[model samples]
Target: MSVLSALGSINWIAVLLAVVAYSALGGVWFAVLFAKPYAASLGRESLPQPAQPALFFGGPAVATLFVVITTATLMAALNIDAAADAVVFALVVGVGYLAANTVIIAINPNMPRPLFYGLISGAYHLVGIVVTALIVVAF
Candidate 1:
């Protein structure tokens, strides 16, 4: 079957829910838990204002949509229909790729406090992937 066809078999509502999960999780993670540290890491005294008005929603919306589509494609590729399978796939992708690379790149010579960035960024991706996977597979 074509990869697109595989995704066609998935419940679209599940895909959307997964996308929303990432944004919602990000809201809690950045705005509440790691707000101060994340801002400080960026050399900002507080959450920096976006230069453009569209950034508040547009940025995360596009990125999350991209991720959801990719995840659906991967699920189709792997024939992953169960939530447990989805979680395993997501963890592998999140930890092995996203979290690892963020740490490596963010800790470069010019960076300050790599640990804080690593902790916050890593948690965001890992948690996001887990939540997305579970929600996508469950419904």
Candidate 2:
């Protein structure tokens, strides 16, 4: 009946797996792949380290909470019953994320190169969509 209740009825394991997968994807991109180059481009010695000792170790925990809340709200509203449906839902959410990030980059001219930032950011959501889809299908 409530949105949280509707979401609670779904498989939490699947949701968590999707969140972890997406977070890992982002970590790899920001930490290993582009960290140095992006930081150099920004005229900084290093990428801004995330604030630690928060929830779920910090970044990943916050990211997981975001995904959970958004996905739960979506499932409640859309009444998703199948994995394929969840995939579509994730893709739609990805677009919203893309738009938001794009707007942020536009508003902040000092951000990284638009193309590079967009590509990396887009990959993050792509991971989220794929993982969410897989979770929905498998579980």
Candidate 3:
């Protein structure tokens, strides 16, 4: 099926909920759970306030939306109505795409501790994707 057709099959409300759920996970993961390790991953003593706090927060929300949309589209296209299949799809996409990309993105000149950053951020995305899949399939 075409991309447009796949999009048409997606449940928008589920996508919205999944987006919100995934974005919220970012807060719990980065701010509350792994705050110290996250800071250290950046080679910092603590979390630095971004000059543009809006971008700091809003950027992830927007990215979360995109991720949910993509996952939802794929789910719809593949006719993944079952929870078990949804989870399998999530794991494959999460590990193969999101986590791998996170690690690759972490390996840069600005990242002093790339592997550490990857461990924290990649794990967050992995869990977030699973949450997203469950939410989407539930609806």
Candidate 4:
């Protein structure tokens, strides 16, 4: 099935709730826990704040889409049927995201602190996991 068709089988309310919760988790993590300190450490004058509501909303929406696609693909490829499989998938994706971010930061030292970026990326992927789990459970 196409990604959209797979996602169409899900309960959107749960999917959205997961996305919002995850996005809020990330926003708080970046904005409060790491934003200023990370920017200062990089000798940056300021971090780029969201100029529009969409900027804040768009990311999680895209992330949710990504999770849906990934989960659907994995479920098909691995024949995943258990909650444990969903959890494992989340962990694997989180690790892969961290590694990718590490490479990106290594290539561009001007990027935010490794720990900060890693945390952000990890949390984002975890959120994706939760969203995927909710979809699988609901469906």
lDDT of 1 by residue, 1-139 (tens): 5787876777788788888889888888888988888877766755565575778877987888888877777777778879789889999988987788779878977767777788779879888888887877777
Which 10 residues in a row give candidate 3 its minimum summed lDDT? 45-54
**How high a TM-score does candidate 2 get?**
0.66
Error at 69, model 4, angstroms: 4.1
lDDT of 3 by residue, 1-139 (tens): 6678999888899998988889888989988999889989998856565565688889999989999999988888888889999999999999999999999999999999999999999999999999999998898
TM-scores of the candidates are 0.82, 0.66, 0.93, 0.60
- CA deviation > 4 Å runs, candidate 4: 1-8, 40-56, 76-79, 98-106, 112-116, 127-135
Segments in model 2 whose C-alpha atoms lie over 4 Å from true places? 1-4, 33-57, 102-106
- Report, for every candidate in turn, its global Cα lDDT versus the true structure: 0.81, 0.64, 0.90, 0.60
Please name the candidate that would achieve the greatest TM-score relative to the true structure: 3
Write down the RMSD of all candidates, one decimal each: 2.6, 3.9, 1.5, 4.1
By TM-score, the better pick of 1 and 3 is 3
Q: How many clashes (backbone N, Cα, C below 3 Å) per candidate?
A: 0, 0, 0, 0
Best-to-worst ranking by TM-score: 3, 1, 2, 4
Which lDDT tens digits does candidate 2 get at residues 10-98?
Answer: 67776677677767766776679877754554546454655556554567657665766567656765677677787777777767674
Q: For candidate 4, lDDT tens digit of each residue in 1-139?
A: 5555654555556556656655666667556876776456454637575465775668767765666555655565555567777777766765676446544664465664566555555555566565566565544
Relative to the unseen true structure, what is the C-alpha lDDT of residue 115 in candidate 2, on a scale of 0 to 100?
Answer: 59
Candidate 1: regions farther than 4 A off = 45-52, 104-110
